[model samples]
Target: MIEVLYFAWVRERIGVPRERIETEAATVMDLINELKLREERYAWAFDDLTSLRVAVDQELSGFDAALAGVREIAFFPPMTGG
Candidate 1:
């Protein structure tokens, strides 16, 4: 099982802060594809990969990052500096 966390507008669109999912995805992008197939909410939240940032196991990562042995993944809008 993987712990998926959503933050900022990603959370608002998905209507949840987090969820635990059992998946067979091999990479972060694959996981997003799976989620997008689950519901429109997920699709909407992940519609634009350019507007988002991702973390794997609490460290910043890319969509192609391998998911093997990963325990957590988070999605949020790209951070902005003041």
Candidate 2:
């Protein structure tokens, strides 16, 4: 199981801060497609990949990044510098 964390509007849209997911996804994009199939909320939250950011095992990664042995995945909006 992988720990999936949602932040900001993602959390609001998904109605949860985090969850444990049992997946057979090969990459982050595959994981997202799995989630998107689960519910409309997930679909909306992940609708625009360009407006979101992702992290795998606490390190920044892209949608095509492999999910092999990844224990955690986090999704959040892009951060802004002050």
Model 1 Cα lDDT, one tens digit per residue, 21-69? 9999999999999999999999999999999999999999999999999
TM-scores of the candidates in the order shown:
0.98, 0.98
lDDT by candidate, in order shown: 0.98, 0.97
Candidate 1: regions farther than 4 A off: none
Q: Write the per-residue lDDT of candidate 2 for residues 1-82, one digit (tens) a residue.
A: 9999999999999999999999999999999999999999999999999999999999999999999999999999999999
Model 2 scores worst on lDDT over the 10 consecutive residues at 60-69
